[model samples]
Target: MSVDLSGAHWFKSTRSAAGNDCVEIAHLDGGRVGVRDSKNPHGGALVFTPLEWDAFLSVARGGEFDRP
Candidate 1:
C-alpha cells in the first residue's frame, strides 16, 4: 500500500551526527512509515509498512548495520 507524505511530520534522529548526517522519519497515512534524509528533505521519501519498519529498527538497534 502506498501513502502520500507531502504533509507528514518529519523527525530527525536525536543521535544524529553533527553535520545533519542522518535520516528522518514520519508517520505517514495508512499506518505506514515515511523515511528521508534530513539533509535533503525535498529529495524524496520512501514509504514502509509498520512491520517492515519495526523489523528494520530491530536490526538497526542491534548494530547489525553499524560501520566499524
Candidate 2:
C-alpha cells in the first residue's frame, strides 16, 4: 500500500530529549502510520498499517524492546 506522506505532520515522543537520535511519527490516511528519523526527515519512512501499529505498540508497552 502506497501512502502519500507529503502532507504528513511528524511528531516525536515527549520523552525524547534535545538530541538528534529520535523517531518521528505521522498519522496517514486509511488508518496507517509513518515512522522516520527526526534527523533525516527527507529520508524514507516505515509505513505501518493500523493492525501492525497496534501490535507494535502493545509489545512496546510491555517493554519488549526495552534495553535492560
Candidate 3:
C-alpha cells in the first residue's frame, strides 16, 4: 500500500549533532513508519510496516548494529 508522505512530520534523535547528518522518523497513518535522512528531507523515505518496525527496534536495542 502506498502511503502519502507529503505531510510527514519528520523528526530526528535528540542526541544527533548540529551537523545535520542524521536519520529522521515519521509516524505515518495505518500504523506505518517512515525513515529518511536529515540531510535531504525531500529525498524520499523508506516506509516500514508496524511489525517490521517493531522487529527492527528489537534488534537495534539488542546491539545488533554495535561494532564487534
Candidate 4:
C-alpha cells in the first residue's frame, strides 16, 4: 500500500558520520515505512510494508550485506 511520507519525521542513522550522505527513514500509516536520501529530502521516497521492513532489517542485521 502507498503512504504519504510528506510531513513524516525523518531521521538519519546514529551511526552516520559528520557528512550527511546517508539515507533517512520514517514510519508511515497503514503499517508502512518511508525511506529517502538525507541529501534530498524533497526527493521521492520508497515505501515498504511492515513485514517487508522487518524482513529487510533481519537480513541486514544477519550480515547479509557484509562484503565477502
- Give the whole-model CA lDDT for all candidates, comma-separated: 0.85, 0.94, 0.92, 0.87
lDDT for residue 46 in candidate 3, whole number 0-100:
96
Better of 1 and 2 by TM-score: 2
Task: Name model 4 segments beyond 4 Å from true.
Answer: none
Q: What is the C-alpha lDDT profile of model 4 across 1-68, one tens digit per residue?
A: 55666679998889999887999889887768889988888988999989999999999999999999
Clashes of 2: 0
Q: Against the hidden true structure, what lDDT does model 1 obtain? A: 0.85
**lDDT of the structure predicted as candidate 2:** 0.94
User: Which 10-residue span in candidate 3 carries the lowest summed lDDT?
Assistant: 1-10
On TM-score, the candidate that comes out on top is: 3
Residue-level lDDT of model 1, residues 1-68, one tens digit each, is 55667779998777877787788889976678998988788987888988998999899999999999
Write the residue-wise lDDT of candidate 3 on 1-68 in tens digits. Answer: 67899988989889988888999999999889999998898887899999999999999999999999
Please say which candidate is ahead in lDDT: 1 or 3.
3
How many clashes in each structure?
0, 0, 0, 0
Q: Write the per-residue lDDT of candidate 2 for residues 1-68, one digit (tens) a residue.
A: 67789999999989999897999999988889999998999999999999999999999999999999
Clashes of 1: 0
Error of 4 at 57 (Å): 0.5
Ordered list by lDDT, greatest first:
2, 3, 4, 1
Q: What is the TM-score of each predicted model, taking all chains together?
A: 0.77, 0.91, 0.93, 0.89
- Model 3 spans > 4 angstroms off: none
